[model samples]
Target: MDVRISVIIPIYNVERYIRECLQSVARQSFSAYEVLMVDDGSTDQSGRIAQEYADRYSRFRLIHKENGGLSSARNAGLEQAKGMYVCFVDADDYITEDYLCRLYEKAEETNADMVIADYREVEEQGNIIVKELGQPPRQGCMDRRQLLQALTSVGECHYATTVVVAWNKLIRREIMCRHFFPEGRLHEDEYVIMPLLLECGHVEWIEEVVYLYRQRQGSIMQSAETAMRHLEVLQTYQNRIALCRQLQEPELLQAFKRAYFWNIEIWYYLMRTRYGVESSRLYGVFSRRMWGALLRYHHVFGRRKTMEYVIFAISPEYYLNQYFK
Candidate 1:
């Protein structure tokens, strides 16, 4: 069958929610789509359960592989995807019946290389928070520079800002296959999305909340072992700077620098907490590059928060205690 869209769901030990996730896909009004259940070496019944779906549905296929992280699982699914467009879904999250249809519609209508939709966060306590994750005037498409600006928007969290999530986006299979998430890294979205967007000619943002992001306490992101994941984002932000420089886009570079300072803020937060060891290692690296960061993002200090980063560059301890306190 000709697959118009490929839904790649990476599952590992999510037996409790895998059925519901698959159910959402089954509910979709759109056909001509294939589901790749990447059973990333789940020890629980998650793998077996997905196998059952494969048995029942002609479109659902299972790829059993070694216990690689999320990126590895996604990469495996991507390798086998035979679709015009692709989107990712976490095993624990569910989507609306119209999720794929709406995103696919936008892509088809605009001939966009990428289409981003807003999502609602469903907390464990049954509270749902609707998030407008993209920049405003959200119904239109953005060019390369506009996409960069939206991504680096100054907000607590929105679309491309802190909301650079991969799951809510529908990307052309051709564009997606050209770039990939780094294996074994938390916040893989941060590193992957910008480069992908840079290569895309247009990005369409629809304000529809078509996705349900389940926030659970037991998730890998909430685990203490991966708390140090915040530390790895430093490299991602630095890589973004390099990416911006490569494109020779001063405006985009400035925008990315503003976002990179957010990484500095996170490092300071980690330093103040018990995760000091990981933070300290980042601190040394930041210290050596302090002058460079200062020079690179100096234009952004006109804002109050960035002005604070001026002092943060001097002392992580002081920034953590006084200004950030």
Candidate 2:
């Protein structure tokens, strides 16, 4: 049978988790798929573990490169992928047995450029924290307008933002190749996923919990040293806002403002609690941007949140205290 899907696993120093992750992919019920294990110069035994799988499985290919970053590794996999559809799976996370089968079937059924599967976030010890994660509010095949609406709607706990993540979607190889992940950037998913979705003429959402995302403490998203880098999200959202304006999408523009504001609000609290003096300096810069966006799109903020952000602009400490106290 011809290769139908390519599973790209970007490996770093995830020796502790690599075996389990690879095993999950190897056991997928779907048979017509190839696995590309891109080892980004791992210092641990991750490369060795991946090589063993490659040796054992004829379809598994191991490619090694000097340590770049997550984006670099994924791009490397993309360079060598032989399948029509591509699915990204992080080295530290595993998937359910039917993950590929379900996503592939959905894409075929809907003739979609992308198919998004729901996931579960779990602790390292195997306890699930969030279930049915990343389900779009709407189900079945969605057009570009419907998909954008679901993605831009930042209200009600923001259902589709988690779907923006790379690992949970099966994308047509050509669509994914249109916009590669931005190398050397944190939150790189923010840079590419939305743009890809916007370009897709057809997209589909399935409710199955296929991917299991591990919420580990020392990972890039959780580490204290890299936490400050999340400020990059502000710039990412700004780019999205510009795109909305260019597309003449007032609904998207307004929704992106609320989404942008929500992120800045989060980063402000994180910085004040963790970085102290540096937080104040950054907050001054962030506050100006926040106020500017709010002025243009304040209709999306509503009365209560607008008042709260006003307090945040004047006295961050006072606004933060409302949460702590």
TM-score of each: 0.87, 0.88
Clash pairs detected, candidate 1: 133-159, 134-159
Q: Compared with the true structure, what per-residue lDDT tens digits does model 1 show for residues 237-316?
A: 78878888888888778777877776567565654464534545556655555556777667765777656776777766
What TM-score does model 2 achieve against the real structure? 0.88
* lDDT for position 30 in model 2: 95
Looking at candidate 2, the ten consecutive residues that score lowest on lDDT are: 150-159
lDDT of each: 0.80, 0.81
Best-fitting candidate, scored by TM-score: 2
Model 2, 1-325: lDDT tens digits are 5899999999999998899899999999999999999999999999999999999998899999999999999999998888899999998899999999999998998898999887777888768885443445557876666655555544324356556789999999988888899998888987886689778888888876788888897453344446667677678878888777877878767877777777666667667665543555666666686677667767886698788887777766667778533
